[model samples]
Target: MEKPLILVTNDDGITAPGIRALIKVMNKLGTVCVVAPDSPQSGMGHAITVNDTLYCDAVVVDKDAPQKEYRCSGTPVDCVKLAVNEILGRKPDLCVSGINHGSNSSINVLYSGTMSAAVEAGTQGIPSIGFSLLDYSLEADFEPVLEHVEILAKQCLEHGLPTGVVLNVNFPKVSKEGIKGIKVCRQADAHWVERFDKRVNPLGREYYWLSGDFVNNDKGEDTDEWALANDYISVVPVQFDMTAYQALNQLNNWNFSQ
Candidate 1:
């Protein structure tokens, strides 16, 4: 059997340690091709380059690595689009994004370029997964999560994800032994309490820096937030469909003819 072709990408740019570590694991599983942002695009969500020209160039970030890599000057979603539409000659068997520097759990998925890349691939009928670590540091250790990453990716390849669904996997910042297990769970009903730090620049211009505290009010033990808090890796299946099916019947009862 031919080795499965795997497409790997991330929002943290091509040379990020997170991605480099991911490539190492992927190379062991199958043929790997990386198409990622040329620079950090952390909270870009599913944005595409519409107003500006896009560029994707072949590059050798690690000459020793076997995978062919491209550095794209666009959002994370743009990388997947280019990979699928232009780069790869055939549809990839699997698409994996991130090993991101921070968490993409719960509501953060709405603002994450990492998860958005996976969501983009999922929309194209590819089995996709977005992996994130709870630590937000540039030098955060990803060793503990590598085993779980391999396991999940292998499982995805073995048993394809449901139509239009992608996986959002988040790992706690713990040692390999500290990890309890993996939990397939739902997104926690949580949100950020935000504030803007208004300040003046050296030229006396006003500026605002966005900041916030994460508040989890949902006490459900089956949520992604709860799983991470208890040292288990959380895997939430996300779908691209945004329709509210329950609201259809309720709105149909309204008197629109009057």
Candidate 2:
């Protein structure tokens, strides 16, 4: 049987440990092609490199497997677009982003380059999944989630996803044993309570650092937040369509035609 062609990418840049770990896992499953950002683009949400000139270079990052590697000077979404449109000779069977250094659960998914990359691929009708770890440390151990990645990625390959949907998979910052199991869940209704600390720089210039604490207001046990808190991997099926369908009839009854 032919191996699956997998497109691997990340927001944490090509050289980051996160993407490297992801590449290692993907290499086990199929023929892997990596086209990721040249530098970190973490908070960029589904952004493409339209305003600036984009550059993609074929590089020998891993001498053993030299040909399928590329580095791009664009957001994670651009990496996918470039790989599908310009780089790869064929469209990939699957697109996987991240093994992100930080979480993309709940509200963070909206701003995550990791999730955005998967969402971009989802929009292109490719089967996609985004993997994230709760640990934000540069040296965080990704070994724990690797097997889980294989499990989920293999499932996506075997079963395929529904139209317009991609998986948002997040792991807790726990040891492999601590991870009870993978839980399929809905996105938690949560938000960041933000505060900006205003300060003066060395040259007497004012600067502000954005900081916030994540607040989960939903008490639902089936939410992503609850799953993570309970030491389970959370898999939220996300879609690009942002329609508020429940409000359609309510607004129609408002008599806008009058």
Candidate 3:
């Protein structure tokens, strides 16, 4: 049997240690192809380069790097689109994004380029998974998530994902005892209590720095927040469909005939 062709990508440019670690692990499972950002693009969400020209160039940073690696001058989503539409000779068996340097649990997924890449792949009918570490450090240890990622990726390749859903896996920063295990859970009811710091720059122009604290109000033990708090890797099945089925019947009663 031919080795599974895996497409790897991330929000954090091609050389980030997180992606480098992910690529290293993926290379062991199959033929790996990477098309990631040329520079850090954290918090970019699903934005694509519409107003600017896009560029993708072949590059190498490691002696042990995958044979097919391209750096993209676009968002994480754009990389997936390009990889599927132009780069790869055939549709990849899997698309894996991240091993990201921070948590993408709960509402963070809305602003995550890491998860966006996987979400884009899922939309394109590819089995996809996004991996994240709770640690926000650039040098965050990826060793803890390696086994968990391998198991999940292998399962997806063997079993395939349910249509329209992709996995969002997040690992808590490793402690002295290391990661406990995996927990399949739902996203917690959470929100960021945000504020902006208004200040003046050197040019005397006012600017604002966005800041916030994540608040989780759900006490449910079956949520991603709870799993991550307990030191287990959390896997939440996420779907891109934002339609509210329950609201359809409620809105249908409104008078619009006039």
Strongest candidate by TM-score = 1
Error of 2 at 86 (Å): 0.2
lDDT of 3 by residue, 1-258 (tens): 999999999998999999999988898899999999999999999898899999999888787655589999999999999999999978899999998999999989999999999999999999999999998898788886787789899999999999999999999987636778889999999999999999999999999999989999999999999999999889999999999998999899999998
Residue-wise C-alpha lDDT for candidate 1, range 1-258, written one tens digit per residue:
999999999999888889999999999899999999999999999999999999999999887889999999999999999999999988899999998999999999999999999999999999999999999888989999999999999999999999999999999999999999999999999999999999999999999999999999999999999999999999999999999998999999999987
> How many steric overlaps does candidate 1 have?
0
Expressed as tens digits, the lDDT of each residue in 59-167 for candidate 2 is 8687886238999999999999999999887789999999899999999999999999999999999999999999998899999889999999999999999999999
lDDT of 1: 0.96
TM-score, prediction 2: 0.97
TM-score of each: 0.98, 0.97, 0.97
* Clash totals for all candidate models: 0, 0, 0
Residue pairs clashing, model 2: none
lDDT of 3: 0.92
All candidates: CA RMSD (Å): 0.9, 1.3, 1.2
Model 1 error, position 146 (Å): 0.5
Which is the winner by TM-score between candidate 1 and candidate 3?
A: 1
